[model samples]
Target: MTDRIEKIVRDRVGEEPVCLFAYDLDRLAEHVRAVVDSLPARCRMFYAMKANSADPLLRALAPLVAGFEVASGGELDKARAVDAEAPVIFGGPAKTLAEIERALRRDVTRLHAESALELHRISEAATRLGRTVEVLLRVNLAGPFPSATLAMAGRPTQFGISEQDLPAAVAAARSLPGLRLTGFHLHSLSNNLSAEAHLELLAHYGRTVAGWEREFGLRCEVVNVGGGIGVNYADLDAQFDWASFSRGLPAVLDEFPAGVREVDFECGRYLVAACGVYAAEVLDVKRNHGVDYALVRGGTHQFRLPSSWQHSHPFTVLEVDEWTAPVPRPELREASVTVVGELCTPKDVLAREVPVERLRVGDVLVFHHAGAYGWEISHHDFLSHPHPEHVFHADAS
Candidate 1:
């Protein structure tokens, strides 16, 4: 945890437990700016808003990113709310008619049509709005893809158009009126760890798309290689080799067919995962049947990534010495502990068997690498627990 966040936790005087998500906006902006700066020419970075759509984060990213990639109508509205004029790309497996109309009305930069039927939907909506909409067909390649934390295309996932159905989808995109086929969206894996592997995948996509352009006699302007860059949750020190990846981009672009003008990356987790922390006050510490557990005021309802991914989320215990309780203060020292939340369910766990030096009542469990998919994917209203306060910190000039 940063000193700014520690100060925020230390300065609190209330008897009630403190649970909040603290975002370092300055850090976020600096990280994103560096990522953007490292990209080669003709490569665009679009912020995938589904990861973390907080207003402050969006505002921080608006100028740095080429545009926003919204997966739903709600995300589209939020993206527009943050920056009225920023370019927006709508994408999702199941897009409603209302969403299609709204995207046309909102003047989105492109709509990534997931299926042939979706292409028709966009055509109908765009025609009704008297607007010509640009589109990219999202393909679920028939790939024995590189191993990753999650696979979106290799298996029978309801994510994108199957590889066999590409011909039909392309036919629909071309035949449908009020639609311009810009390129393809080939996002195969999720939480991919290797830069070299990602570069290899990009090269494969370029080769595949080039073949398609030749076979179909089509020209693609923007080939959006959907972002699956992974964050190192287990080892924060060892992260995705982005510097190497950026250096390798020119070679990948060189391999692309001349007509493919630009490559778009819709990254979400890699951009903002390291810029926030989930800090929750420890309510109690106890040993249950030979196992130690530290119960906190908050749980999976506020931050669900650890539980959803079933990983021991890395965290530090911030000792709070101010124990004004009249009774004995419960404490755990030099033990491997499972950190749990106030949720009634047995599955409300964050860290399991995490070794800690000294943890006491009122000490804060600071979860790192929580900026992306933390609160955004959580079920907040479960058990009617009060929402964690969102605390954003920025260094003053």
Candidate 2:
């Protein structure tokens, strides 16, 4: 955290004290630029808005990415307002017919058909619209990923069509009018930390797509390798090796079959997670049952990532020198303080028994890498707690 960001937080706090969310757009732009610049010529980048669709974030990434991949009608509209002519790819496990109609009416690049029924719906919508529709069959591969915090494929889930049923599905899609099977979308993992393992998956996708094209004789133009580039929250020092992956991708692309022309990436968390910091004020500090605890003004309702995954959210203590309380401040030196929120549940804890040099009642705990799923996914209405201030910094180091 820089002095300028701290000042920005102070400014946002104003007279009445409350939790604050600081988003560094400058850092966001820098990271996105690095990722886009390192890409191979045949590859394309799409910002998965489901990660963080905050206006500032979308606007910052609008010019950098090839387009936006949307899951809802609202997000599609939000994407166009930011970038009027950016191509959009619509994909979801469950999509309403109205949503499909909306996507077809607009200038969508491709609708990733998640099921045979969805494929029929897209065909029906396109036929009704009197326009041909481009689509990529989202296949749920049946295997384990080399290394991942969460795996979406390899099992029967509500995500995509199973690999065993692809031959029949592809044939059915081909037979449908107003539908073109342009490629396949394989989003197999979430929070994948190994670059080598990711490369292996990419190669597997290329080989799999090639075999399908030969067996089904479909013209595959784009192989959409959905992104799960990880953020190493546990070991902050370790990060996904983008540079090495970028260098190795060209060779993998060379292994693709004759019909494959382009590769698409739909990246979400890795793009925006590092730019946000969620700051909350410590309401009180006390030792309960021989264990140290600090209660904050906010709870899982405001920031749910820690509670959702049941992980000790990494945070840094921002010391506060001002305390107007009449009672003496609760002082602790080198203590393991388990930070709990205002919610009345055991699951409201953020960081559990984390070491801190000095944490008082008025100090702030700033959770790092909260830019993606922190506020957007949290339950804001619980307990009717006041929302945190969103403070954006253009030039925070």
Number of backbone collisions per candidate: 0, 0
lDDT of each: 0.91, 0.86
Look at candidate 2 and give me any clashing residue pairs: none
lDDT of 1 by residue, 56-111 (tens): 88988899999999999999999999988899999999999999999888889999
Model 2 agreement with the true structure over 1-397: per-residue lDDT tens digits: 6566677666544346559888888888999999999998888999999988888889889989999999999999999888778989998899899999998877888999999999899988889999899899999998767767777899778999998889888987889999988889999988898888898889988888888878887778988899899888887778999889988998888767766777999999999999998888888899989889999878789889888778888888888787786788887779999999998778898888899889988778888898988888899988888988887778532
Using lDDT, give the best candidate's number: 1
Q: Give model 1 RMSD, 1 decimal.
A: 1.0
